[model samples]
Every structure is written in structure tokens, then in C-alpha cells.
Target: MKSHLIKDVGAKLMNRGHRAILAISGGRLLSAPFGMPTVELHTVGRKSGLPRSCYLTSPVHDGERIVLVASKGGDDRHPDWYRNLQATPDAEIVIEGVTRRVTARTATPAEKAELWPRIVASYRGYADYQKRTERDVPVVICENR
Candidate 1:
């Protein structure tokens, strides 16, 4: 599948449904599915300055640190949430019914080189997503404050 099609499915369907379920279940559902953790990331809009929330699966999680990929289903443009983190690295994430403050940063190329295989091992779709796009997908590390 192409990047745009995947993006559309996420932006238009799955994400919305997932967020609704998570909210309705009070952070109990839609988290750590099949042992892979998912967090609700809260970011400020880069342009609007409004708050935005995105649900993302973390391929790597240790203690209070999590790694997120700004793949947007391999879309050409980075997801708005990732751009928001770029403009404002300070953010919050909801994990397992708790909200924690965090700081975000893109991993360096060397870091990505070491991390990529581990990440793809955790979730194979990311590797497929990379194959679908020409841009280098960003790997963002969000650390607890």
C-alpha cells in the first residue's frame, strides 16, 4: 500500500476509533496491546498553539522512556504531532492510566542506525513503511521529566 492511503486510513479511521475507545475506557483499553505499549501523546500545535493528542505504539520502552517513530504511515510529511514536538519539545504522555510530563528529541543518525533493527524487530510494519517513503522517518525519544 502507498503512504497516502495508509495515512488516510489512520487519519480518517483507525486513530479516531482508537482514541475514542481509549477515552471511553479511561486509559484502560488501547494500551500495551499484545505486549507492545501505546501512549497518548499530548503536544502543542506548532502553528495553532492548540493542544493535540495522538496515540502511538512504542517499539522501545524502558522505565519512563519511550521511542516513537514519526512515520505517519510513511507519509511524505511528518505527522502534525511530531512537528508539534519539534516546535515544543516539552510534552505529556498518558501511559497505563497515568499522565507523565516528558521531553522529546529526534535521535541522531548513529542512534537510529543502532536502534532501527531492534525497532523493526519489535514491529515489522515500520520496515515496510520505510520502504514506502523516500524521506527518512524520524525516531523520537520521549523521556519522562
Candidate 2:
């Protein structure tokens, strides 16, 4: 699968708010282009334990080692998912139709500086997103099992 195709299909799914499915499918499409599709992570709320899902892009294998940015479309407040991960680093991820347990953590300042450019280079919108917010965006790294 090609990245452009994944992006196209993903854009369609996202427009319809079918994010989970989109992520699942997109991850498969990313196999050849992006090396492998990232897993779609679903985490339970620390307080409520309710399920929450997000599409993640990884620079590693099957989201086994992944990084997420707290762009939140560059909003002032951090994304809710970021807070959720903070409350509980333990989470679930679905990759290529398989689900697995994983851990999540915020990257250190130095790590973020080193990784941010790579992220921006891969997804240019991130740089644009930064321009919209005043607070620094956080970079989250998810380690999968």
C-alpha cells in the first residue's frame, strides 16, 4: 500500500468520523510506504475507564515503538487523549487487525527536540499546527508489546 492511498482513504474516513476504522485500514495501507502502519490505540480513562481511541503514526514497527504529538490542531489546551495517556501509560492498541497491550509516556524535552523535526518532516501540518497555539506541544512515545 502507498502512503498517498492511505492518506486519501483516511481523509475520507476522518471526514465521516469513522476514525477507528480508518486507522485500522490506514495502518495496513501504510505497510509499504511508511514501512508499516501504526496501531490504532484505544485507552481506558484512568478515572472513568471508558474507552477512547486515536489514530497514531509510528516510526517503528506496528506501533510497537511509536510517537504521538499533542498538536490538538494547535489548540490552547492539550488534547484529551494526551491527558488520558498521562493518567495511565498502560493502554491498548490495534494494529493490522490485531490488538495488543502497550505503554505510553511523554518524551523528555531533549527527546522531543530531536523527534519533533522528524515528525514535522513526515507530516508538515504539524508545523502549521504549532503556529496556532501558544503552549508547547508534547510528544508522546508509545511502546508496544
Per-residue lDDT of candidate 1, residues 62-131 (tens digit): 8868899998877777888888999999999877667889999999999899889989999888998898
lDDT on C-alpha atoms for all candidate structures: 0.86, 0.70
User: Which sections of candidate 1 miss by over 4 Å?
Assistant: 1-12, 25-29
Indicate the residue-level lDDT of 55 in model 1.
Answer: 84
Quality of model 1 by C-alpha lDDT:
0.86
Top candidate by lDDT: 1
- Model 2 scores worst on lDDT over the 10 consecutive residues at 27-36
TM-score of 2: 0.70
What TM-score does each of the candidates earn?
Answer: 0.87, 0.70
Clashing pairs in 1: none
CA error at residue 126 for candidate 1, angstroms: 0.4
